[model samples]
Target chain A: MNCLLCNCQLSMRLCITELFLPIDHQRETVCDACRARFSAYHLSKQCCPGCGHPLNGELLCSECQAWKNNYGQFLHHRPLFHYNEAMAEYMSLYKFQGLYQLRMVFQHVVQMAIKQEEYDLLVPIPVSPTTLRTRGFNQVEGFLEGMQFHQLLTTIDDHKARQSARTRQERLVSQQPFQLNNNVRVTGQHILLVDDVYTTGRTLYHAADLLWQAGCQRVKTLSLAR
Target chain B: MQKTDFYGRRVLLNAEEAQQIRIPNLEIMPAVKKNGDRIYCYRCGQTSSCDTSHLPNNQYYCPVCFNLGRSSSLACYGHLAEPNHFTLPTSILTWSGQLSPLQKRVSQAIDQGMTNHQRQLLWAVTGAGKTEMIFAGIAHALARRERIAIASPRVDVCLELFPRLQAAFANTPIALLHGRTPEPYQYRQLTICTTHQLLRFYHAFDNLIVDEVDSFPYAANQALLFATNNAVKKTGGILFMTATPGRTLEQQIHRHQLHVHYLPLRYHGHLLPQIKINLAPRWRKNMERGLLPLTLIRSIKATLSAQHQCLLFIPHIDDLPLVEQVLYRQLTNSRFTTVYAADPQRIEKVQAMRDGDYDFLITTSILERGVTFPEIDVYVLGADDSVFSSSALVQIAGRAGRAVTRPTGRVIFWVSALSRSVNDARRQISLMNRKGRCLQRELSSL
Candidate 1:
């Protein structure tokens, strides 16, 4: 097998348990060198509880403070990795270039992270109909393969620019682009929202705000990158 | 959106650009075609078993050539027939440089091959003015209104060849294409591009000259070979120029399947420098202990004392830091730097070496080909390592004694255990030198 990212030949040695066990597990899709490029977030570090951004001994970041003032409640988001250069390159290939095979690089990590969170419904952020048509598969859904997730939200048909193209101020002031799907039960239920990346906290906030209006008891969010 | 952009090229267009292509003569086809259980990419010409590169809704994208652009079943490619729209110029050859008599002979053979549309190979030694020898052939093809392209496997070779080609074909419009080039593609009679960029072309060139055909990533890559075959017209000619032809090309020559031209001597009619092998065991262990072999250090000191630069070719990049430290400790007064493929300042470092700024350089095989440093000696510290192919070793040895003023220099290989590649490299150099000696005698008598 070869790494999905670097295309180097992989020689995976079989462990004792793997050699004896009859059950087949998913093989590694990336080499150790390529995998080492992505760094996981340090949860022990002082960070904002609202958005998980690194903080210098502060209660909340300015963006999360604004979120708390507007909605009377802020989302508690757990991000897996930092949005460093390697992560940015990974996003460009996996999302922009649409290399479907690259989803395997981080699928297991995202799955394992999602498993740690407790929620009644795992709701993945939805792509617009146009994006669904063009990009084929929803990027957030690509990371959630073989797992149970609810597509409770659907994006509104707004032909606006992509979030990545917008500046920070523009992304912060952008209006909500998501709505709850028809006839979804969310009253008094704990909801967990999933997204591929949490850039300025606007996208996840929009989805969380809709779920809050739908009378969910509590809402939490998780993303692959901050 | 110009019609000329799609002429003789298979271009992937987005939704916005696809709508603007209003040309009626253009042929449109799916970027990828799906068979029973496999999907074939039209651009790279590779078929995969639909297990890994699949998408939703029975769609698939090619993973092989995804770096150029994603070619999927959902995308379509536009190909306009090659118009060959070139205006015949009054004077196509602007190069005033003189070629040696032997070089002139090889140049005529290349011109004949291009005229007859036959596949040929030019087996020239290093520093034989191979680029100058091809000017007449390219000029002839341009005069006949036939499109020509010069491609190489390495981007460095393409970049170096582009300016020389521009100076040679002064009036002809030449386009330089590569992965990182910011300029958009244009319809030019002549083009200089890397081999990877040839995937975007379809029967585009009447004559394609591939320099350094035995170099890496193109020497044995099936997809690139397929691209070369697909990029040329059915009746077009191909001329592969290389100092060290690989086993496949050698077999082709042996079978009389390929027309061959040999320029065994250098432009100055001098023979190649022979390689001397010295066994140096535990060199890597000693390097880790901050020490170099006595023989290797003596050779470096000798070259430096003689006021000549030397290149120390290591087997791997991982050993560069250790070797650099050892060299600094041993030769404290001399100035040097180490370079590898990923070094951001590799080009600048090579330029500095050419300017006589450094006494010696520790480098990997990245500088083994397509570079020249005058009045320099060459040494391979780990010549028996698996990384040093026979061709690579020969290229490294060729780096020395290239200038006319310094027709001879030292070439040494410090090997722990002599291997077949090392032996083969030494034997090949001797054989070339023998042939070059015979050529020299004949020319002197004449």
Candidate 2:
């Protein structure tokens, strides 16, 4: 099999290892050289307690500290990689370019990270209707391709600008854009909010607030990039 | 009173809004197909089915052309109005350069073809001043208040032609469109763009001229052919100019689908440089053993010592590093560089060679055409390889002896075994030279 990202011939042994082992996060769609280019976040690195951005051994980064000060309810977040140049290019191709084949490049690693977590339900942050109409596929749902996830939270406003388009301060102070689905029950359940990138923690916080209002006991967050 | 830019200029939307402004200009052509909820676009012609969306009713979006601002079923092509104003200069052809008698003859035929609105093929040999011959025809079209577009298969050709066209038509506003170029799309009397950019235009030009029509990704490609056909208006004309016409174009000529015109002589009145073959058996094995073939090494030394630049062409990009290392050891006293298609320093290395900073440049076929270096000899390491087509071999030989001062240069092909492509290239060059000699004799008698 050839890697989908680079079209390089993939090793049969590596494919077999990926098929048999869960911890072996090697992907058939990604070549070894391209995989090495991604700056994956390590648990051993000094990171912020809230957003998971790499830090200098501080308990919390200043941005996370500001978030904690503004809102007492901080969602516990885990990120798989730092927002390096390679990750930025990956997002540009997968999200902006609508090259859905690149979703396979980060599938295995993100799935493995999600498997290590403990949560009753996984809910991906919903995209605006305009994004779905234009981009054809939800990028966060693309990362969680085969894995099971619930669409409990629906975007409330179709005309609201995307969180990525807003400044960090604007995003932090923006009104809620998520509304819990009345038919689905999130009450008294541990919910994990997933996204492709955690830019300012505002999008996840908005989703978490709606779940809290729906009587969810706990809320955590997971993203492919920070 | 609000104004919005449509093509390149701003116009008031009026009270009827943008919809009324877009309606009268657009008439849906056979370029759109509907199957159930999906629609296929004939413009970018790359996909069978576009993704359907649930906005403004069920709309279909061509995902392939999303980068070019979403060519979809919801969008209508801009209807270009006929030019009612003729802002012709006193002398439209501002070029101070000279064209040979043969070039002038073909140039007049092309101008006549544009006026008659017919398809004509200008089969000129390389170094025949093809671009210079088109200036008169373009000037004629501009004076008639006709929109003109010059499309090529390669971006390098478009980039090279843009500035030359701009300089020739100083009074006319020209737009250059290519994927990598930073120039924005605009409505001009003259437009020069790559063939891929032709998909964005609909019934846009009154006269379309396609250069390098047989080059890669354009020859025998249906999508590009569709774009070329659809880009012109119903009554518009097309002029195809190429050095090496591919098999499809030749078949078309045989079937009388296109009218043929020929200019067999170069601008300097010299014949194309013929290719000479030398057998280099197992040259790759010799390189691995740290020894170079005596015949190939001698060829490189002769050209370098003669104070002429040498362009050593390799068959594949994978062989570049090994060949560069072998040549570095063999030609110890020469300064040379290796370049390939994906090399980041490709442009800089080529400029360095043009500036006479390098004695020799070992390159792949990427520099076979659209590049000219004065008094340079050409060599192909493996002319028998499958990677080297007959047309490519002709173009490679055409690279040599391009300058007016040095009208002749050596073209050597070092092959392990004689291939049909190699023999065909030699025969094509000899055939063109014969035709050129016949033309010269006819001119002398007249």
Candidate 3:
């Protein structure tokens, strides 16, 4: 097998325990060198409790503080990886370039990260109909392949600009683009929203706001990158 | 996009762009085809299982040629029939450079091949002025109003060849295309692009010349070969130029399927520099311990004393820092630097080397070809490594003895153990040199 990112041949050596046990293990899609490029956030690091943003012994980041003032509560966001150059490149290829096979590169890691969270419904942020028609897949849902997830929200705006193309201020003040699916039961239920990246937490906030209006008891968020 | 953009080209377009082009001559085709459980890309001609490349709603995109554009089922290809629209220019060949008698013969053969629309391969040695020789054929094709494109596997080679081709055909408009070219595609009589760009073309060129046919990505890639075959018209001519032909080309030559021409001597009429092998066992271990082999260091010193720059080729980029540390410690007064593909200042460092800023450079296989430095001796630290293919070794040796002032430079390979590629490289060089010697003797008798 070759690394999905770099296309280098991957050499697999079975350990003594594995040789005896003979259990089928999921093969790695990326080589160790390419895998090392992505840096996972350590839970013990000093970070904002709300958004997982690195902080100096602060309870919440300034962005989260602003969110708390607007909404009754800030989102409990857990990002798996830092938004480094490698992650940016990965996102560009996986999302913009539409190399669908690249979704497999982070599938296992994202699945494992989501397994640690407790939620009644695992909801993924939806793409605009235009994006769904053009890009052919919701990038957030692509990471959650082969897992049970609820498509509880749908984008109502047809001309919603991509978050990547908008400036930070434009993204912050942009109107909510998402709406709850008709006849979805989320009342008094814990909801977990999934997204590909947490840029300014605006996208997830929009989705969470809809779920909150739908009478969800609580809302949490997870992303592949922050 | 204009009608001219789709002329002789197959560009993937969305529904909006497809609706804009209303020409009756436009041939629209699906970007990808589905058969059972497989998806076949029409552009690259590769079949993939639907599971790996599928989109939502039973749509599939080709991941192989994604760099060109996303060729999913949602997109369609726009192709306009090639009208061979070219204005005959008063003067096509602006290059006044003269080819030698042997090179002139090969140039005439190429011109004839192009005229007859035949497939041919020109096996010319390094520094044989292959570009100058092809000017006559390209000019002939242009005069005949035949569309032409010259492609290479490496972008660096295409970038280096574009300006030279523009200068040669000064009266003709030329388009340059690559994965990174920002300008939109235009209809031009002549085009120079990388081989990957050929996937965007549909029987575009009547005469296609592929340089460095044995180079990376082109030699080992089947999709590129399919694209090359698809880019040319059914009756069009193709000329493959390379110093070393790989196994596939060699088999074609043996089967008499490919017409072959050989220019065994350099333009300066000198035999290639012979490779001298030096066994340096445990060199990697010693390098980690911060020590280079005594013989390698002495050779570098000798080449420096002779006022020639040195090119130290290592097997991998990971070994560079180790070799660099030892070089700095041993030759503290000598000016040197390291370079690799990922180095941000790669182009600048190569320019600096050309400006005589450094006495030597430690580099990976990225600099194995398409670079010429005068008065330089080459030393391959690990010639037996699997990374150094036979052709790569030959190209690395070709880097030496390029300039007329110093037609004979040293090429040494420090190998821990002898390998087949090493033997093949040595044998290939000697075979060409012998052929060159025979040509010289025949010319002298004449």
Candidate order by TM-score, highest to lowest? 1, 3, 2
| Candidate 2, superposed: residue stretches over 4 Å from native | A1-27, A30-37, A100-109, A145-147, B1-39, B47-66, B72-91, B95-97, B180-185, B305-307, B341-357, B384-387, B404-406, B416-424
Please, what are the lDDT tens digits per residue for candidate 2 over residues B281-357?
99878767876668778888988788889899988888888888887877888999999989999999999999999
The candidate 1 chain B region of ten consecutive residues with least summed lDDT is B13-22
Q: Best lDDT goes to which candidate?
A: 3
Please give, for residues A1-226, the per-residue lDDT of candidate 1 as tens digits: 8988888999877889988999697788989998899899877558899877789978988889999999998999999999898899999999888888888988999999988889999999888887766677889998998899999988888733589989999998998898788787999999989999899889999899998988999999999999
Per-residue lDDT tens digits for candidate 1, residues B335-371, read 9999999999999999999998988899999999878
Candidate number achieving the greatest DockQ relative to the actual structure: 3
Candidate with maximal TM-score = 1
For B166-278, candidate 3 gives per-residue lDDT tens digits of 88888888999898899877889899999999998888889999999989989989899999999999888899999988778878999998999889998888899999999
**Distance from true position, residue A162, model 2, in Å?**
2.1
Candidate 2: chain B TM-score equals: 0.82
Candidate 2 chain B weakest ten by summed lDDT: B1-10
Q: Which pairs in model 3 have colliding backbones?
A: none
